[model samples]
Target: MYEQFTKPILDYSIALVMFLLLSPVILLVSILLAISHRGNPFFLQERPGKDGKIFQIIKFKTMRDLTDVNGKQLSDYERLTLMGKIVRKTSLDEIPQLLNVLKGEMSLVGPRPLLPEYWTLYSEEQRRRHDVKPGITGWAQINGRNALSWEEKFRYDLEYVDKISPRMDAKIVLVTLEKVVKRHGVNANNYMTMEAFKGNVA
Candidate 1:
């Protein structure tokens, strides 16, 4: 009942409230990122949504487009600005996703949309993670995020899809809030962000 009906309505309402309540903070960060990056404050990338639908996911741009002398791209750690690190650590970078939820491309609680390139790489079981709209926070995110291996993360995503009870979502939400407050696992141990998923686990 919650998944098919109540949850979407509730999620929309909550997103609306969040958008209004946090508008000032969002605007401030947007301006900060724009000034720091000298470009668009928000970055949009196509991600596979429910049933493999493509949707543009929005996020605050925290990294600069710094290239080396040969024009080779710099690493994330190198490109990440001090403000970027602060935004990422506080998860203030994700505020724009409220707009995505408002646009119906997402839910408040579900498997997070992954890179579109990951579509071709997913095994049948792994693909089940996209059975519902993506979310800003989810079972996998709260559990470990960058700390977990790709296989473990995908398993959590599929697990969330299979058993999407309202209680479960509430738990995920609560845990996500706590993680944000604690600023845990915001980045991988040796990477500026979680390492990109190369392929399905063999």
Candidate 2:
């Protein structure tokens, strides 16, 4: 009952309310990102959502388009500006994704939407994460976020897929708040952000 009807209703309602309440902060961050990037403040990229469907995920532009003399884009650490790091650390960069939830492309809680390029890499079991709508925060997010290994994160994603309930969702939300408050696990081990997931090896 909850997964079929109640969860969607709650997701939409809560997303709307949160977006309305956080509009001021969103606008402020957008302005800051615009100044930092010298242009658009929103970053839009195609990500695989539920059922492996593609949707453009929106996030605040936390990095600038900095290029090396060779005309290649710099690494994430180098492109990440001071304001970008601050917004990312505080998680203000995720505010734009509330619109994704409002648009029905995401949930407030579920497996996070990952890059479309990774579609071919997920094994049959790992691909189960796409069975439900992706989320802004999930079981893996609350557990360790970028700090966890890819295999561990996929394990949590599948676990959440097996157990989708209001109780589980509530617990994830509460823990997420704690994580953000403490600014924990925003970066992967030794990387400014998570290292790209190379295909799992045998």
Model 2 is weakest, by summed lDDT over 10 consecutive residues, at: 188-197
Per-model TM-score on C-alpha atoms: 0.96, 0.97
The runs of at least 3 residues in candidate 1 whose Cα sits more than 4 Å from the true structure, single-residue gaps closed, are none
lDDT of 2 by residue, 48-114 (tens): 9999999999999889888999999899999998999999999988889999999999999999899
Error of 2 at 67 (Å): 2.1
RMSD of each: 1.1, 0.9
lDDT of 1: 0.91
